[model samples]
Target: MNLNIFIITSYSFFDQDLEKLFLCNLKYQDFSKNFKNYENYSKLSSNYKLDKSKHWITNVTHLFKFSREFKNFIKRYTNYYLLNCLIFVSIEFLPEKIASVVLGFISFQTFVDKFGTVFSIILVTILQMSNYHYTVLILTTFYGSWNLSEDLLIPYFNKIHFTMSEQNQWLNTRKGVLFGIGLVYYIMMQKFPLISFIIYSNAFFNMGFLITKITNEIPDNSKSLGTWSITESVWDGHDKFLGESLTS
Candidate 1:
């Protein structure tokens, strides 16, 4: 997957406001402290140097890296150029579906490439879960709640398909009931104090992702991984998960 293209797209999006990158790069501590003027600029410059190192890979330089697997993969898929040409070359035929046409073209490239890296930055931005950079690794991966230990054991559950109506009812009825129970639990949780605090903490943090399910709006596409919905919420919230057995 020619990741140079995705890197360029990430760069272009950030380039829209040049100063924002600089401002966000500044150490919040120093700005709050408001030290001597010259010392502030010098510290900011030093901080910016480290920040650039963190963000540079997301810039133009990630285009090239040594990988024998990458070369062999590209060699095996020599038809991609022809595919790109054939798709765009026939675009004018769909005069009525202009949006669909453009979308088809973009999706073709993105699908072929599997745009994990580009969209990840946007997801991380929305979540505000990681540093603008990865902080520890060379790339921004596993935006939050990731650790080295037991990375493999964490199970991934894909579509255990439920019909939209069943899914909706599960979310609206079951989840709404749990949410009401959760609210009551949260209100009186202070009585037990510590145990209640733990329950409330986990509940509020968890309810962050579940509020969508308590409504009937699962996103149409599931190609994007780890895109959670209310189904997971009710399964956890209401103790009625069918596991991988259920299917649409």
Candidate 2:
């Protein structure tokens, strides 16, 4: 598998982007332990120069040919994410299970679109009256946070050279996003909260979305679908969470 990965990665420059990305972000998951010495972390921060290094290689900025155009794309993309999240989170608590109806209507539209709004309100209605989890609901606010963070945090994590502990924290954050959904659901006995967090908090601006697209390889090998732009939908098997609840 390693050789195959190398062969696939080395053959095409696009593959190199993937290898570099995985190595840059996924590979050194544990070096943070050594950095726990504080001195090491300080050295890293100094050497890396946090603020100055915001635009790491292959991020959204460099990837999109037109910054203005990309911003528009991000606005649409973020809206889509926030909208679906609004729906999925809503359905989690609904006793009657509008998942079928919600998903059916949503299936026809991308959340980033205007149509997303129509379905979102409808789903929110279904869940508002059903069994829900407040803890999960509160934490799920992070859905928007995660979405927002993805445009910034995930890539930033990728850019910074991390220590093992730092990497662990990173992994935790990523996993927590998924695990919390399920854990909270089980604990809360299903009664959840209002569906405004994701929508009201971030108003689908192009800035963050565009920021997510800092990378520039035509075929992005870094992560899902060649998009250095953040806010991707992934399947962690362990994290079907609201996705499963809503889709089921």
Best by TM-score: 2
The 10 consecutive residues of candidate 1 with the worst lDDT sum are 148-157
Model 2 spans > 4 angstroms off: 1-100, 103-142, 149-152, 155-173, 177-248
RMSD of candidate 2 to true structure, Å = 17.1
Highest-scoring model, lDDT: 2
Query: Which lDDT value does model 1 have at 40?
Result: 28
Residue-wise lDDT of candidate 2 within 78-192, one digit each (tens)?
5645665666665676543555445434433422243367675655456445444532343334343333333323323333434435444444435544334324332332232
In order, candidate lDDTs are 0.32, 0.35
lDDT of 1 by residue, 149-232 (tens): 011001101122334454445434453344344445434443455464344334433332333223323333444212434344
| TM-score for each predicted model, relative to the true structure | 0.17, 0.24
